[model samples]
Target: QQQVRQSPQSLTVWEGETAILNCSYENSAFDYFPWYQQFPGEGPALLISILSVSDKKEDGRFTIFFNKREKKLSLHIADSQPGDSATYFCAARAYQGGRALIFGTGTTVSVSP
Candidate 1:
């Protein structure tokens, strides 16, 4: 139960539209949740996150809605724009071995004019 799954390898949203990205996990042991956003050729950076204790999180135009019972979560980007186009990764941590994080397959978002 160490798998994080994501859907839609790529998505395109018109400017001002909301971009919805979906993710799910199989590991119930995972307690840390973080969403990472990356531009082309750049390392992923934390965009926003929600602990399993919370059902939702928000930061500016970015928001994450989580369903602990379903083991699912989603990221919503409001006011989509060309500048917002990037690759997003869903990740989780469990303090195992103090190694690193477990990342999802990643979703590439394209905001069109």
Candidate 2:
């Protein structure tokens, strides 16, 4: 039960629209939830995160809505822009040791004109 899955290998969202990326995990022991946004040729950065104790988290144009019981979560990008085009990953911490994150397959979002 240690898996995180994401949908849409890639997406083309229009500017000003909201882009939604879906993620789900099967592991119930994971406590920490974090979403990383990566631009072309750049490392992923922690865009926003939520603990299992909470159901939602938000930061700037990014927001994470989680459902612990359903073992699911989603990333919402408000006012999508071309600059926002990138690959988004949903990660979780299962083990306390280093490299605890189990990342989703990832969703490449392309906000276009």
Candidate 3:
């Protein structure tokens, strides 16, 4: 089973509209949450992240809202652009050493000009 989950497997938006991506996790031990964006034929890259202690985190056009108690988080992309189109993955990592990040299925976002 996937420890992390994403909603709206796919999404589309106008160039200037905002795109919202949702994520949830199953492990309470997960203390770190990172959102990754991947372009076609490219590896996923970290976009933004938040710790369980934080309620919100933002970077430029991307923001992440976290709810530790509920084990949920959301990524908001402001000013959606066609070049922003890509697959987004929500991931979680525990303090356990020697472990790679666990990722959610993914959310594909398409921005139309």
**Which candidate gets the maximum TM-score versus the true structure?**
3
lDDT of 2 by residue, 1-112 (tens): 5399998789998899999999999988888889998987889998899999888888898989999999999999999988888899999887566756889999999988
Model 3 residue runs over 4 Å out of place are: none
lDDT of 1 by residue, 61-107 (tens): 99999999999999999999899999999998774658468999999
lDDT of 1 at 39: 97
Quote model 1's TM-score.
Answer: 0.93
Error of 3 at 73 (Å): 0.2
Cα lDDT tens digits for candidate 3, 1-113:
88899998999999999999999998888888999999999999988889899999999999999988889999999999999999999999997876678999999999999
Task: Report RMSD (Å) for each prediction in the order shown.
Answer: 1.6, 1.6, 0.8
Worst 10 residues of 2 by lDDT: 93-102
Count of backbone collisions within predicted model 1: 0
Selected candidate, larger lDDT, 1 vs 2: 1
Q: For candidate 2, what is the TM-score?
A: 0.92
